[model samples]
Target: MNRHESMLRIAASSDISVLLLGESGSGKEVAARFVHAHSKRAGGPFIALNCGAIAKGLTESILEGHRKGAFTGAVDERLGVVRSADHGTLFLDEIGEMPFEIQCKLLRILQERAVMPLGSCDPQPVDFRLICATNRNLRAEVHAGRFREDLYFRLNVFPVKIPPLREREDFNTIAQEIWKEIADHNPLNASEIALLSKRKWPGNVRQLKNVLQRYSLLKPYDITLGNVLTDEFSEPATVADTCTLYQAKSRRIAETPEWNLICSELSKNSGNKSVTAQKLGISRGCLNYQIRKHSS
Candidate 1:
């Protein structure tokens, strides 16, 4: 993230078109907005389009504008994204999914710096910095004849690759930053933080948010490694546990902030680790490890 931030800082000052390559939820759109906000075109309108979301027949008209009589439903003249974002930045997400027919028009728009609306006799000049993002491998798509090679070359001018969440060295810090978005407080302790770091968040930040949100929505929210890893807290509410999750059985003793109490338990059981572990409702190994940890 440090290196990526540094690149964003340097890239922000220039008007070079950028291609953001990363998995879904890996912050491509976030980076696109960042670049637009810091660029010279910051004062102008910032337009965004998701090519994948648009229907096949409407993609070109929506992006390149159309005259009132261009199509059956065209009652009013509408400006394309390029013209709408003239003198500004245009972010096209999921560019790989754009139909091949519209790709040629988009390429022309980039090369000629002009757009001709459907059924229009004149091509209007436009000026906008382009930023594109995609989770798919455009190179492979090009090799497979699904993407336009020339268009890919044009958009890949200032390529920026965002790393996956697990590969980021600042994992914990980033997770906490994301956690703060939906969480009112940072309730994760050191051990729990370490556990989350070790989790396999396949959906990246998106998955992590769902997970933490699930815990946060508990009858009485409590953040702990055991609660996060187990189904103990997700059980249906009962009269005895109406106000909160069953603390007696659902609460993991590891979250206890009393190291001295463990020592007392150890002494109370006459130094028998097995008896102490049973009384504390924790494994013997866990008790022993905690004993050694707090003793040191």
Candidate 2:
């Protein structure tokens, strides 16, 4: 977090195109928001779009507005995300997922400072800082020809890599923040939080948030090593009463609709948390919260 904070402070003062590189759940979007909030365009709108969520066919129309007659579904003229973020910041998440053709258009926009809407004759001038993020190895993508070389270099002007949760030494602090947000009646005890700090979370902060949510759902709504670690918890804590604690929290799992949906999705996905999170259009953190909420 310190590394990112320092980089964000340095990047926020400039209008340079910045790229955030990290794992999917490593908080790239959050870092982008930080940069924008502290930048010169802080008063302007911050428009964020997930490139991976948009299909190739609609990418251009989405980035640059379309006239009413541009396409089959076009009902009115609109300023797309780029123009909407004029004088502000435009954050493109999963930027590496953009198609080759769209990359050309994006490069053009960055270079020319203008965008031509679909079915429109005149190019509207635009001025906005661009912040792109991706979990992909973009340099490798350029080598493999999956991502454009020019576009990669353009967005890579100021790259900031966000470290994963396990690499950060402040897991306990992060866990406490999550606990405060999700805990119903009480916060996790210090010992329980200590135990949580000892292990690694592969999914990064998103997974930690999920795990912390589970801790909040323990039988009596208090956190414990067993509730967080379960059989999957690593580097077992020195606390010897975790077994009895686990048994106590196993009394009953809430049967809410959300809980049922979570179970159904997990079963359908064969319990693959990452896939399930993607299918649900949410982060693993959110999915974990959903699971712990009902399966307590």
Candidate 3:
């Protein structure tokens, strides 16, 4: 089996928490669903939570059940995510954003195999696996004290890292797969497929899906490479307008000093502002200011 298939297999048999690390829009949630579908707990519910999407104050109440009188607006008993994922899997997207306190509670539940609901005396047993994903480097966060080391270790068992689309060896195969998916929804000719396959998808699979969706709506009778590479592919603007902007930016970069080259290199290195600043032997704010100046 390929790496992706192997990952699914490992996730299927293991009850240990799996950490999926990948770039944004790299189909992390899709992989998580594949794991849950193939696992022994396939019959159970698959609960997904976006840690970054939830407010800090509501996170605890969301993870643990709340009694009728637990808080101000608690008029009825509410089932927390942990209880909701009873015999299935809890897929936590952007797990790095989970608060340290909530992480402690999560660690406790994973260690004890039980969850103590809010305003509840007794802890209820739960049999479930966790599949957490994050775009951020949790190790660095642990060192920075933004994330708890104990919680990181607890949730990082059987880690699976999904490569970005740009690094995928099976780029042609993936492109073909995306083409088939697009064709299922719309009737795209060979020219359109050829055009799409050549363009760099910075937004990855999600972006590809959106492109196909848009093309289907605005079905052009005669699709060409130029048409597919229009400004709509980048943003909501005319092709000429986007090209003008691109040319202007190119000219500005060309006119800049060696610092622009340094910034470009730094951006290629995952766009970590601090790292860029360090490499340039300058303060982070100076690097930021220079980048802003160049961008303007």
Score candidate 3 by TM-score against the native: 0.73
Query: Measured by TM-score, how close is model 2 to the native structure?
Result: 0.77
Question: Between the candidate structures 1 and 2, which one is better when assessed by lDDT?
Answer: 2
Which residue pairs show backbone clashes in model 1? none
The residue-level lDDT of candidate 1 at 219 comes to: 20
Number of the top candidate by lDDT? Answer: 2
In candidate 1, what are the lDDT values of residues 219-275, reduced to their tens digit? 232344466545432556577666353365345543543777888998898999889
- For candidate 2, the clash count comes to 1
Please write out the lDDT profile of model 3 over residues 91-190, one tens digit for every residue. 9999998877778877888889887777788888987889999999999999999999989898888889887776666666665676577654334456
Candidate 3 stretches with Cα past 4 Å from truth are 169-191, 221-225, 232-296
Candidate 1 residue runs with Cα over 4 Å from true position: 219-225, 229-296
Residue 161 displacement (Å), model 3:
1.2
Tell me how candidate 1 scores on lDDT: 0.79
Alpha carbon lDDT of each predicted model: 0.79, 0.80, 0.75
TM-score of each: 0.73, 0.77, 0.73
